[model samples]
Target: MSAKLYLYPGWLRLWHFSNAILCLILIVTGLSMQYTTQGDSMISFQLAVSLHNICGVIFVFNYVIYFIGNMVTTNGKFYWRNWGGFFKQAITQSRYYLYGNFKGESCPFQVNEEVKFNPLQKIAYVAIMYVMVPLVMLSGIAMLYPDIIIPELNGISGMFLTDLAHIISGFVISIFLLIHIYFCTFGTSATSNFKSIVSGYHD
Candidate 1:
């Protein structure tokens, strides 16, 4: 029998759903802006820009909630790296995903309050949360006020660099979303992970 654990907190669920919705809005509007022509766009260029900016602002607030909540709660420990045997643990986890799991081997890591993530998950989440998300946020802000931070280098404006960074970061985050969804299916049931987030219980 699988054990049920109270893994998610109410605040986290709120922040998570908020972030997910905002991300969907941003992604749709962003792609529309990128590939849509003026006459046949799904959303008008102006409307897309407005929605992206609005959702981005809301996402910032949700991100702040997540960051602060983690810092103030024991949940923060979930992302911490134990330096001892870190590499070995990471390699084992990678092997489980790549080879062992296909052979019916059990996972090397299991979720608990103190150790919620495997080594590989810890690293990926840390990079995505602390590095990529922040980079994307800052770049998006910079794009809004190009006049204040304009630095021309080799005939390229700083605005171009900021936009490039924002686009690349968004793309990386989108890819992460796909991988994350795939892993969610590894739970006891296909929707187990998702249900855990919604109901605060993991089986």
Candidate 2:
């Protein structure tokens, strides 16, 4: 039998579930606004805009809770890493995903009580949560309040730049979420990690 670890707490699970729901809503609405021609959208333009704004605000608040939770909880420790030989460790993990796993070899970095994320996961999480999130939020806020952004940036519309940034960052986050779900299946069983997120235990 595989070992079990009580890694996820109640608050964390709530945050994860809520965040996932909010992100999905935002993705759908955002796509409707961006890609749909008037009268040809799955969601009406006005309704999509409203839903997108509401979910965006809620997501921002959820992210704030996540930030504070990380600050006060031991869970935050997993995101930090020693820079020494980090790339090599990430490469090993990559090899495991690309080749070793196909050969039925064990993972190079196993999840444990002290280490929840492997090297690549740590790197990806840090970039997404810290860099991309902030960029997207700031850009989104600027877009929401157009006056906050300079009227013209190098003769280009400031709102245009802000919107572009928000779209790109949001796209990156969406891609990350898909990959995250894919990786969740790499646990002991195909559903083990999904169960862990819900039950607060990692198998």
Candidate 3:
């Protein structure tokens, strides 16, 4: 008989679901923005920009809550225990994914509250939360400020920089989403992992 596992706390569930929605919106609006270039005005670029920005702002604010909650462990979590365990788990987990798991082998590490997030997950989420998120937000704000914030950004050079950064940020986020979807099936029950992110519990 399998035992119930309490993987997610309430705040993590709240953040995960809300963040997922924001990401979905960003993806759709981003696509819409590109679509306008082909003369398809069904989803106007201006409107998408506004929606994306507002959602981005909400996400950023919530992310701050995510950080503080982690610090307090009010949610019973931390990104990882320490640098050493993090690296060790990450490498072992990567090897598991590459070789062990495909052979129907057992996972190298069993998860619990303290050892949550296999190495690969830790690395991916850390990168997405730390790097990709900030990069996108910065580029988004820069785009918003091309006219008033900086003379360099308002002109051709600024436009090029902001567009390149924004597109690159979007590309990274898209890759993360695809990887996340593919890896979601790795849990004991196929849908349990996804459900945990929504409901705050895993059984």
Worst 10 residues of 3 by lDDT: 74-83
Backbone clash pairs for candidate 1 read none
Off by over 4 Å in 1: none
Q: Considering every candidate listed, which one attains the maximal lDDT?
A: 2
Top model by TM-score, which number?
Answer: 2
> CA lDDT of each candidate?
0.86, 0.91, 0.77
TM-score, candidate number 1: 0.94
Model 2: per-residue Cα lDDT over 54-164, one tens digit each = 888888999999999998999899997455789899999999999999999998988888889989899999999999988988897787788899888789998888899
Query: What TM-score does prediction 3 earn?
Result: 0.85
Q: Which whole-number lDDT from 0 to 100 does residue 48 have in model 3?
A: 88
- Model 1 lDDT at residue 47: 97
lDDT of 1 by residue, 1-203 (tens): 86788878899888888888898898899888888795988899999999998998888888899999999987787877465798899999999999999998988888865677888888888999999999988888777667765697678987787888899999999899888889888777788898899999888
Query: Which 10 consecutive positions of candidate 1 have the poorest summed lDDT?
Result: 75-84
The TM-score values for the models, in the order shown, are: 0.94, 0.97, 0.85
Two-way lDDT contest, 1 vs 2, winner: 2
